[model samples]
Target: MQTPLDTLQHIFGYPSFRGEQEAIIDTLVSGEDALVLMPTGGGKSLCYQIPSLVRPGVGVVISPLIALMQDQVNALNELGVRAGFLNSTLSMEQVRETEQALLNNELDLLYVAPERLLQSRTLDLLDSAPLALFAIDEAHCVAQWGHDFRADYLRLDVLHQRFPQVPRIALTATADVRTREEIVTRLALDEARQFVAGFDRPNIQYRIQQKDNPRRQLLQFLRAEHPNQAGIVYCLSRKKVEQTAEWLCREGFNALPYHAGLPAPLRATHQSRFLREEAVIMVATIAFGMGIDKPDVRFVAHLDLPKSIEAYYQETGRAGRDGEPATALLLYGLEDVVKLRQMMSSSDGAESFKRHEQQRLTAMLGLCEVTSCRRQVLLRYFADTLEEPCGNCDTCLSPPETWDASEPVRKALSCVYRTGQRFGANHLIDVLRGSSAEKILSLGHDRLSTYGIGRDLSAEEWRSIMRQLVAAGYLDVDPEGFGGLRLTEQCRPVLRGDQPVFLRRDIKVPTARPAARRAVEEIPEADMGLWQALRACRKRLADEHGVPPYVIFHDATLRAMLEQKPLEPRQMLAISGVGDSKLERFGADFLDVIREFEYTHS
Candidate 1:
């Protein structure tokens, strides 16, 4: 009987369990349940993978990511774990063989779609087959009000009713206090041991800047820091995704567009290319990144605002899955806030749900406007806290200077009041900066006392003040859904000159600050050739096997090979990530590259 640690070292090539992994694995292997809330790339998969191997029967993983199951299974097979998946992508013959394998106890782990797993036929088949436990991935989908709700996932509690004795482990990367409670209620995991890991991804530098020509900003940022690296660029609309992808391609990047609007086959092809190839940038909508397993994504850039803090966290969490340095950037504007408000107001959810969403959006906006460490506010949203400011976010890296906006805010609020609160930021700015625009003259607002009083500040500066006011609850978007600015009760103190106002000075021509985590592993000039040769060997093997190069051996493993310069097969096994299966399969090729390099250098 192999222990969990033994399975981890011998199979997954990891030396020790991370964080609460060992605890979670023990609960499951002992035939108990656990609900895990670990961050992405925090080794959530191993909590179940190890228990499945150590326990007697096959572990059943229920997830909605059918498109990703094949890649996961392929990676597992490379580790010498007998893993298989049942999804629409497989033919009937293949499905039959998999079912038979499950019955014969040949598979150590099985991945099943939530819909398929809930079917009566599949349930009956599982009843007769030996099972270790059920592992539910993306467990937050159980919350009806969650950002990524799936109706099928809400009924996952059926597993408990049907298989009462089998242990169940539910896992998710993003879940708030409310969502966590809802997950416990819906999944019938009332007694399940809960493991809540910290939500911080220290390797990811959090950055949010006011939108100023987003395309140019993205291009400059990429050219400056992340050129030729794998990344995801998120757009709010399908059209924007396509346009950005095309634009990036024109700008000499290997970019592709992915959206639900695309044909399914085309989406699959683009996804495959992004996964199998290096340096591919995927321009996509929210439809693209759920359950994405790509490990080396260096950055996730948002051209627009995400709807909530959870959505932002989930989207950005996709980067740096391999625990290397990464960046999560957001470029937003006042229009983005209005658009997001309109989106919330139009949703078909219950009033309470919509209000909850609105609050979340407001918090998201606050995050963008925050003057303190972005990481602190982000973790606090998930009920986790960092006592000290994280030295990794935009604010912590380059603290913005604050201005006393006492007089400016009063004038801005008075302008909104005198104008009947029917005008948006542009009109208000026009009124403030004394524009000779037709609408202002048509409305005869050029004669008003509040008009033209703000000429002391630039239009951009006024815009920044108004944006911060809205974010801080001093101003509200028109309740009538007219996209106009209105004064809130919170502004009364400022209106009476009793409150002092402060705001961050928005950066003009903002500089690109890349992720401030540790640098990439250095390969000396002499060792660079062997490094390239090893990567080339890995790429060729990955292409032949039809899997991603990382699954062959991650970049970290390749660097270890470079640093250690392992010359013999026995020595290769001593490197981390070199298990018996991979060492047997690919060790000779890497050793051959190292030997040739050494001979040439000597």
Candidate 2:
């Protein structure tokens, strides 16, 4: 009778549980429902995975992404966990084979998409099999209003209604207060105990810049910060996704485009290549990246503004999933706001929904303009608190300067009012900067008092003021009217000359400079050879088994082995992520590589 700790160590090769994992597992192992809100790379899987193994029967996992499901099943099979997946991606024969495995109790865990799991055939199969528990991965998709909403996920409540006795756990890496409540209501997990882990991913360094030639800015960030590193660059539109991918490739990066518009087979092929290859940059739209489980993504760069903090957090969380130091760079501008607002307003959703989306986007802009720690603002959105600023973010790294923008804000607001609020930011900025453009001349008579009063500030400066004013609710974009600027009720005090407004000083993007090369994990020169040899061995094995190299051993785990220099099976077993099955299967091979390296060096 192995205890849960024993299973965790002997099977998973981890010495102990991380942050609230043990308690969550304890509840689930005791046959209780639990809703888990953990950050990416926060060990959310172990909460249900451990319970599945410790409980009476096979664990049924409802996964949203087929690729993610396949990856998990592959990694688990490598650990000798007897895992299998049943999804549409599989052939009829493959599905039947997996079905047999489930019915025969040969599998410890089975991963299925929400739609597949809800099928009558699948439900009947599960009803006959001895079930351990139900695990819903990426449970945030259950919220219909969420950015990553899936209609199929809305039908998953039947799992509870059908398997009433089996304990269930619903998990998500990104969920705010509203999304969490939706999950509880939709999943029928209200009675389930809730475990909300801190949303901070300390390993990720946050950086946000006002968009200045966004494509070039992205190229600079990649060249300086993440040369040859595996990363994802998110664009807001499909055309941008394709163009960026093509541009990055021409710039000599291994980049590929992914979006819903791409052929399904092409998208699958690109995703497969990204997961398996090193230093592959995936340029994609918001349509991608919901259930990506890759662990070694070094950066997640945004070429446009994400609609909300939740979307931003979820997208950026894809980076550094292996708990390594990673970077998240966001480049935004006034156009992003105006364009997003236009799209939202034109959407067929109800007015209330549009208003809600507008609020969410406004919050996202506030985050972009934040002068304090990025992590602090991000966490506060999810109702979590960090005691102090995370020193890794751009704000904490190089704090921005604040200035009294009351005069400029007042001028910008007056320009909007005097122009009949019919012009967008570009035209409004032109009016303020006294541009003699034909439209400005034809529409304005060049006679307004506010015109040319903004000559003291640059055009970019005026644009920043208007954007921030909108974010601060002192102004709003009339989405129904071609994204024209309009004064909000909140602007009354400021416009009336009764209040002063301050804003972060917006600066122009700096010229691109060569980045200083960072030391590779600070590994000593002497051990570098052995590290390469270990990687080669892992890669060879991964190729032979048709799995990603990380599926053999994560870079972090390999680094641990390098540091520990394990020379025997018992010593290898003691390494984190070197579970019993791994020790039995490949411990000797890895130990031989280590021992031979020692002999050669000596």
Candidate 3:
């Protein structure tokens, strides 16, 4: 029998197993179920893919989205893998062909939708096949309480009852304790070994800023940190998505909007363009990017607050999927909080469910308003404890100082009260700054004692403070009420000078200037000859495998190996990005090329 390592190299062109991948594969191969909670880009596919190839029969994969299944099938086919997907997109003729291939044992894996899998014909087909295993991708969808819940997922437990002989594996990138339990119970995975990988994506720098002229802030960020890198900017509303995309395009950025409201073909075209084009920014609503496989997104920006932290994390995880550095920026304001709360409160869920959702929303708000390390706060949400702060996040890189704002807050509160609390933050700010705008003069009665008292702080700073105040529960935005600002009871102490209010000063760190656009790094001069030879070999193998060239070995990995000239598998492991999994799986094949080079040179 071939060891898992052998299958890894022969099938996937890698040398060894990634963290817990080897263990999980070993357990599954030993006829045990497994639940894997690996983060995005953490090689979750390999755990099931490798086991499927090594085990006896065809692996049955249940996926939720047709587009996602199509992409996976396309990628596998490119690698010369006998993979096929059954979905609504397939014509009757195509479905017949796929069924014939499956029955004939010509395919290694078959991807099906949950609803399709429950069909009597599909189950009968699987019953006759030499079954290797059952794999559920995005397993968290099983939980009705999860962010992307699907009712069909609850029926997956039927697989355990019908095909008790086949081993099972459920995989998801985002799941908390509650969701995990729900998945296990729903799937009847009482005996499954659980593998939870650390959720830390150290390469991603988390940054949050209060919304003030959000467009300007986003432009500034793009100009400074990621001038020509691929990115996604998420908006809560379709109109905002369209407007933001248009604005970015007017500013000379290659941007497109994607929302459910758009025609399906237009959305598909925009998605395809984003994938193929470099440096394109996609402005989209939450409806976009469920199983996007793009590997080089440099950033993910949110123009509004996400519904919950899980949604936020999953969306942001789309960036830096290639294990390179990236950024996750959230731009939000008081209005976002109120809107989210109102949506949650009005949801047709049980009281307990509503309370749980409210708590989750509150936690997300805490993260946004936190004055400490953004990374630390994020990691804590996933139950990971970090002792020292990560210096890469905005707060850590540039710590903001705080000033006593008790008196100013009092004056601001007084103006709001005197004005009958019928105004938004902008109007209140104008009044405090003694703006002589016609509206302010007419509505504000410039004679108020608070007028012009807050001129010391800039408009941006005031907005930040107000946002924080709202998040901290000292202020509220009436959702059914025109979003008028209202002071909460918590504001009473600060107004009466019984509580100290220290406001964070806005920090103005110099932005990273955009680097001059250069061609994607080619093989360095020192290993030009070896690099050429490797490319030739990679191209030949890729052709044989019928997969994209990068599937065999990414250009960067190949370049690094060639430059370092690793003599052995262990030495290859030392190469950046060549983890133990790749070294064990593909090391010998690469070493053979190196040995040939040495022989020819001599």
Best by lDDT: 1
Residue lDDT tens for model 2, 20-97: 999999999889999999999999888888888888789999987886777788889888898999998889999999
Query: What's the lDDT for all of these models?
Result: 0.92, 0.88, 0.81
Question: Alpha carbon lDDT of residue 223, candidate 3?
Answer: 91
Cα distance off (Å), candidate 3, residue 598: 13
TM-scores, all models, native as reference: 0.98, 0.97, 0.85
RMSD of each: 1.2, 2.0, 4.9
| Ranking of candidates on TM-score, top first | 1, 2, 3
Worst 10 residues of 1 by lDDT: 508-517
Clash number for model 3?
Answer: 14
**After aligning candidate 1 to the native by TM-score, how far in Å is the CA of 500 from where it should be?**
1.2
Q: Cα lDDT of model 3 overall?
A: 0.81
RMSD, model 3, all Cα superposed? 4.9
Give the Cα-based TM-score of candidate 2 against the true structure: 0.97
lDDT of 2: 0.88
Off by over 4 Å in 3: 338-355, 435-456, 513-549, 561-602
Which of the predicted structures, 1 or 2, would earn the higher lDDT when compared with the native? 1
Looking at model 3, residue 317 earns an lDDT score of 94
